[model samples]
Target: MTRIAINGFGRIGRSILRMLLTSRAEDGFELVAINDIAPLQSCAYLFAYDSVFGPYPGDVRHEDGAIIVDGRRIPFHSVADIREVDLQGVDVLLECTGAEGGRAEVERGLEAGAGSVLISGPSDVADMTVVLGANEADLGAHRVVSNASCTTNALAPLLALLDSHWGVESGHMTTVHCYTGSQPTVDKPKANLVRSRAAALSMVPTTTSAARLIGAVLPGLDGRIEARAVRVPSASVSCIDLTVQTRKPARVDEVNAVLEQAAESPVFGWITLPLVSTDLRMRSESIVMSGRETSVSVGGLLRVFGWYDNEWGFSNRMLDVAGLMAAR
Candidate 1:
């Protein structure tokens, strides 16, 4: 079994734990340890009762350093810094610590003896950045990997598939995402000036590097994409509106049929399901393309819509990346 440790207990970190525990036998992973700046009880409590994913679907109880859940007694290590935590026999550290998962912090996990390290969020020094279905070819014997941001997870596969089939000239993506931990519950003076306002009560527009990040996964598309985001007051689930200017103009039905065919391909995981974000609240698939909303212009512009449970699907993809790296 691939022994794993989670270095952060934020949304992505804890969600990964949930996926691993829920699919342990099928995925062949062993949960060894969890490291976080939060106290053991707080972390355990949060794990036991999450506001977003709802309560823990399985048994989870802890007495200090160790917690029993999903029929496993995993030890929890509370630490202000990942270097301070000791994870014995860890095969991979899913560094889901968001901003804390910088290049240096990831190095600490490597020094602490993790066989490999994969950032659950974006990181600068990860040897590879993979969007599982879109670019599994990028996975190799790299010591560090980045799963990229959740939005990147939603956009990369769609763009990669479209670019391959229709020859994309350029594209624009707007992610309509739900508010995350980085935002405040109420308005305040914050770093990202615009996001300083209330997270729950406002639909804030912000910049995203997902377009630029995808270049690493799909080099040919570099400098050819524009991306942005709007954080609305929803709990979870996100959608991406992609306008692709194809190399040659195609009919609406023709463009959609391409996506429909791509959906049949297992590698891309593009499902042409006629569903909205609410329909995908607890779903696992990364991109659930809305066949009804997919459209093509007379001038070769294709507008495609896709939805995903950002926390769940992205976490599952991260685990998929972990499994691939472990096998290599």
Candidate 2:
């Protein structure tokens, strides 16, 4: 089994642990150690009961310096610096901390004994950024890599598929995203005024890197796509509203048919039935396209709607990338 060490036991970190425990036999990955600033008891409690994912199905307890899940004890270290953790035999150190100085931390992980590093979010310093199906081949001999952002993971595959079948001219995406830890619960001071309001009370407009990063994955379409975000009150799940002008005209039926064939993969899903955010809670597909919501104009303009569990889907991709690295 591949030995993995988590650098941050936050939302993504805990989600990864849950996935490993639930599918350990099939996935062939092991949790060797976890490093977080929070105390072990706090981590254990949060893992046992999550607001979004609900209570973990397995028994969770903490003793000595490890969190025991289903009788398996994984070492837990509470530390501000990852260099202090013993990552001697770790195959990959998952960097989910969203640290601003992530480039430096990647080096620290390499020096601290980890064989490689996989960042949960985008990083300029990463050897490369991969969005699973869209750009998995781009992953090479690099030791440090990024899984990109959740929106990128959700949008890139769809765009790539569209562009492949009918060349894309230009596009714009607006992500109706759920509030995250970055925003405040109540009105407070923040660098971004729109995000300062209560997260559960307002739909705040902001910027996104997904549109910008698509070019990195599919260079032929770079400089042709733009994206923005609206932070909604929900705690999980996000929607992507994308409009693209294709070189070839397509009918609505044809577009939906293509997506339907692509469904059930780790990177994409096709939903024939109507559904809401809460219904998507633990659905593993990175992005699910609603066939009922697709529309295409005679003039080669196409609109697509997609939904994703921001944390769950992205966590799955992180592990998938880690496994890819291990296999190499």
Candidate 3:
């Protein structure tokens, strides 16, 4: 079994742990340790009873400095530095802290004895940024790697397939994302004026790095994609509104067919029925293409919609990448 350790027991971190506990029988991942600055009690409570995912299905309790799940004792660490944690037998350290400490943070995990470090978010300094179905083939024998961001993961796969099949001339993507922990519940002080206001009270327009990061993952479409984000009031699930002008004119049926065929794999999903954001919660696929919403303009301007559980799907992809790292 691949022994796994998690840093930053927040939404992503906790989601990974929940996935492991629920799918341990089939997945070869073992949760050995967790590192977070939060108190053990708080981690336990939050893990056991998540507002978005609801309560965990099995036994959950905090004993000593660890969170025990399903009778398995996993050590938890509250540390100021990543180097302080013992990763002796850890095959992969899922760095979900959302820290931009860059190279220094990755080296600390390796220096502390982790075999490999998989960052949960985008990292410019990491050896490679993998977006599972999009560019996981680029994964190599690197000590540190990045899984990119949730938005990037959702966007890359569709972009890859479309660009490969019909040829992407240029594209603009707008993600309707849910409010995250980064935003405050009520009006508060923040660097961005829009984000400083209430998080769950309005749809705040903001910028996203997914478009810029797309160039890093799929260099072929580097300068062709433009992207933005609007943070909605919902607590979970986000959908991408992508409009791309294809090099060749294709009908809506053709576009939907392309994604439909790709959906044969577990990495992608296809939905012909109308569904809400809540229906997408806990969805394991990186991106669920809304075939029902696919449309093409007279000028061959292709538009596609895809839904994703930003946290759940990305957390699952982290494990998928971790599995590859462990095998390597």
TM-score of each: 0.93, 0.97, 0.97
Q: Can you rank all candidates by lDDT, best first?
A: 3, 2, 1
Q: Which of 2 and 3 is ahead in lDDT?
A: 3
Q: At residue 43, what lDDT does model 3 achieve?
A: 92
lDDT of 3 at 292: 89
Per-model C-alpha RMSD:
2.0, 1.2, 1.1
Candidate 2: which stretches are off by over 4 Å? Answer: 23-25
Tens digit of lDDT per residue, candidate 1, span 173-234? 99999988788888888989988988999899998769679888788899899999999989
TM-score (C-alpha) between model 3 and the true structure = 0.97
Which residue pairs in candidate 2 collide? none
Error of 1 at 303 (Å): 0.7
Write one digit per residue (lDDT tens) for candidate 3, span 57-125: 999989778888888898888997888988898899899898889688678998888999999898988
lDDT-best of 1 and 3: 3
Q: Write model 2 residue lDDT over 53-86, tens digit each, in one string.
A: 8999978999978999889888889888889887
- Model 2 per-residue lDDT at 46: 96
Model 1 bad stretches (over 4 Å): 23-25, 264-274
